[model samples]
Target: MSTVVNQTTPHRSGSVAVIGRPNVGKSTLTNALVGAKISIVSNRPQTTRHRLLGIATFAAGKDAPAGQIALVDTPGLHRQQGKFSASAMSKVMNRAARGALEGVDAAMLVIEAGRWDDEDTLAYNVLSDAGIPVLLIVNKIDRLRDKSALLPFLAQVSQGRTFAGVHPVSALKRNGLDALVKELLMLLPEAPPMFGEDEITDRSERFLAGELVREQLMRQLGAELPYATTVEIERFAEDTSLKQGELLRIGAVIWVERESQKAIVIGKGGARLKEIGSKSRLQMERLFGRKVFLETWVRVREGWSDDETALKAFGYE
Candidate 1:
């Protein structure tokens, strides 16, 4: 038997770094484009701490071109200094964001609808200086009650900078994504696909599991405690000893900077910790497609966010 492959027209393939300020829906847009939750989403700012690659493959059709875009979801670019910022972590995150844009073929600067502040300007300057085609992505338009305001907002943002293209999209609602993807495909260079068509992301299941746990922490704790929390997966392995269906065993540690923060995360009578564990386990099961035995522990690491050694141990380079 011989394997046959269909020969299509020249395929355009390259990477695009998704850059933006904190809480600008960059992760949501990356997940939307890839059709899966590669990057975790949360309402809190600075939710993304690492660079994640989400692969979006556009199939050849009568009205669409064939292409594969490796979308690099980066940490929010911000001018971090002064008394309020975690200086060490801020430097690490900014370094990661800049590194993600170093070799990408193009870039996308995501901004919230009807809002562009100093941080947005900072992000725009960084993306512009990368010397790559930067696409202006105006996200969260679904929040706007008046649709007429979108055009003027886009027009306002387009001034004083030359963007490769401008697109208005609601990532949560999956609106205007097709057009955005099409425009992105046009910007990618002609080359072979870097990843398999079936692959959606370059991150491992363990990394994604940790991110999901952190996401639950951010969502459950609301605006009060998430900034001080970070999840680290200590162990992830399959229990092959089981005779029945596969069971994944995951052990994670929720690191807090102080004992008081740990107590807050654990909550009264351990109810909050239990809730976070339950939600994280459910999400992990869905992502892994198997039974999961999740064990989570809360540990206090004093000033871990500001300590260089602790940051390195927590996988921040």
Candidate 2:
């Protein structure tokens, strides 16, 4: 038998929260759903510490009219220990982390295809308490050799809970995405598009550019450095000299948590920093559809992750 749905009428749209354990591919799924890079992807756990928004456009689906459903990519909830600084920034990312199910019409509980543990249980408990309709998203299935291993685990998670659906998806490979989206649309309430059809996300260009640079750094530096870094775009301009051409000038800062990390990011006499800048510039070009001149500065901000004020400066709060 099929699961019961709250919305029976067609053309429904609403906000859905993507909540999951760390490193379960929440950001990757958000990016795929929007068909744009709205969130940053890192192999390192806890890399996402914000509520990134991805707008999914629906048109003439089986149960709904053309509309947009916003996907909220929440931070991975985790158990923390020790002292936590209470300040402005701590209030933002930390807020996103703890309030994953707040204000969401539905929830997507993402879990690793081959790994399940107490953390998943805790996350589901939190969502269940919030009373949001959930859909189990078994992600990273492409990494598992024996796909059958996920069936029993899926049953375990779905037991005693009201789930809208169960889907196996590989965000990295874009597998099973269409069906997932179709299901989501069916679950949503029909309404006029909240955002324009051309709109992909709610984030500003400056924010996304900064995230793009940070993503490049995360990819190149691996797990060690991805956790300690943040990027902020100070200036983005289209060079006035080329009125008829597409050329952009972007200046950004790369913040490291410690002086030693700063040195490592800068590399031997700045070679590594240059590579990071070049790669980031290429991504900016692809995103902005223009030639990009990107300048990067590396600086040290001690304990920014735990510092609320500093986290606010980096948009974590």
C-alpha displacement of 98 in model 1, angstroms? 1.4
Identify the leading candidate in terms of TM-score: 1
Ten-residue stretch with the least lDDT total in model 2: 81-90
lDDT at residue 269 of model 2 (Cα atoms) = 89
Q: How high is each candidate's TM-score?
A: 0.95, 0.89
Candidate 2 lDDT score at position 84: 30
Cα error of candidate 2 at position 278, Å: 1.2
| Tens-digit per-residue lDDT, 152-176, candidate 1 | 8888888888899898899999988
| Candidate 1 wrong stretches, greater than 4 Å | 1-8, 82-86, 243-245
Per-prediction tally of clashes: 0, 11
| Candidate 1 global CA lDDT score | 0.87
Residue 149 of model 1 has an lDDT of 87
Once superposed on the true structure, which residue ranges of model 2 sit more than 4 Å away at CA?
1-9, 61-65, 82-94
TM-score for candidate 1, residues paired by index: 0.95
